[model samples]
Target: MADPRGLATLPPIRGRVQQAAPLAPFTWFRVGGPAEWLVRPADMDDLLLLLRDLPDQVPLAVIGAASNLIIRDGGVRGVVLRLAGKGFGDIVLEDDGIIAGAAALDAVVAEHAAAAGLAGLEFLSGIPGAVGGAVAMNAGAYGAEVKDVLDWAEVATPRGLLRLTAAEFGFAYRKAVLPTRGVVARARFRARPGQPAAIAVRMAEIRAAREATQPVRARTGGSTFKNPPGEKAWALVDVAGCRGLVRGGAQVSEKHTNFLLNLGSATAADIEGLGEEVRARVLASSGITLEWEIQRIGEVMP
Candidate 1:
């Protein structure tokens, strides 16, 4: 069977669409293949139209900042959407809450909140991804998670758009149960007025702590695996002797054993392979199978 929904046969879209777009530059690791079809939507309405009109067989994936992702070697099979621009990067202070577009960087959201004298979102300053990814994964750091602050999120579904409350998402440790192909458009996070100086201090401390413990300047995906219940992933990686382990041009960050880095010119295959190897070693050494925190997608090169 062939793809029935090629770009030539698609409905009209106001956004820019490319047949194949290089995705390596979109991610932090910078070692993936291209997106078979890349669509940069103009705004939330444009995305909703695309989602509603596209055939169900046409696989849909959205990338926002692309911080903790792995696109496979063979490239994505269908449409890849990158929500950007003022359409999706807008942030506004609304009473006791912050309304952030999906493409709004987590750090930016935190800074905005801090500047507005809102507290409880300082933890977001340490998360490297965007609001959409954070909502998708319930992304957390230090002590708080997205579930703790998310009031509701507007998601573009195949049928139309929906505003789902935080309780609707079955959020867990580093995971969230969402619709099969839901694309988060924007979200409202509950916050309370606090001292601006205190919030700034907290954000600064988190930033410094991250720099001291993690390879913040390196081209690496944040954390490779989620810490198992009552167990740390980095400690297990260290015990398995996977720290600084290398496969092709990919190496586990010695500074932070849980991080996988592309030592320039590495293929996505090498990075994925190294991650599998780490999982094997950790399992063998501790009888605990570490689950990936990073989302891996697309196909292996044939």
Candidate 2:
């Protein structure tokens, strides 16, 4: 089905807007179809205005970095907003914390934080998403999570712009409870002073560790499944004999069982199918089901 809303009826804004924009290039999977309406707002005000004036019946979605997403073959309906880094990727160091725009890459944040001698945000270096996606999913790595250091966040909600405290987010493993349609605009995180040299060393260690264990260079969605309580997802998949398991052009990463990789020509269906296959096999073997950590959006082709 095509997008039901007419772009002509939408409010004017200072941004780049397109109809039937290809979404594959925006995502890590390098697969999927197009977005019915793709809007890259020039700034937060532009985004807010667009959100406030958008038709309620017309769905809205936001994608950042697209590091952990799988867009389906049939494409997404309605307006899909992508915050450009040039406008939303600023990082400011405060007296006691760091403020980052939603579009700032996590690694960049980590590097900046280290340069400013800020500790405790070093874990962000290992996360492959932008600040918005990190907050949306409560993205974590190496025992630290966004919730642990987040002071507050500015979000664009239907009611208007609102400042939400960390506690209000109701964070959980790999998830954050946010307004049904809220868009994170910026976030401020609390950090403490530390030696820049020490912070850099820690960040470097994290990078090395990640590179050694993950298929960081492959066209793959980071982690395919969340670790079930008390059990590692990779171990479960490995025990299920799913390591290197293949479906179409997609395969479970031999380097990391929790990751699913696209071997050159995998479609969205192939990648998702491989994940489901891994989930099924894992469940059948361990009686514990694996939950997908990757956000699979859009619709399947008919």
Question: How many steric clashes between backbone atoms does each model show?
Answer: 0, 0
Q: Which residue pairs come into collision in candidate 1? A: none
Alpha-carbon lDDT of model 1: 0.91
Clash tally for model 1: 0
lDDT of 2 at 248: 93
Error of 2 at 127 (Å): 0.2
Query: Which ten residues in a row are the worst by lDDT in model 1?
Result: 2-11
lDDT scores of the candidates, listed in order: 0.91, 0.92
**Over the stretch 84-163, how does candidate 2's per-residue lDDT look in tens digits?**
85789999998788999999999999988888898999999999999999999999999899999999999987778889
Among all candidates shown, the one with the greatest lDDT: 2
TM-score of each: 0.97, 0.97
Off by over 4 Å in 2: 1-7
lDDT of 2 at 176: 90
Error of 2 at 94 (Å): 1.0
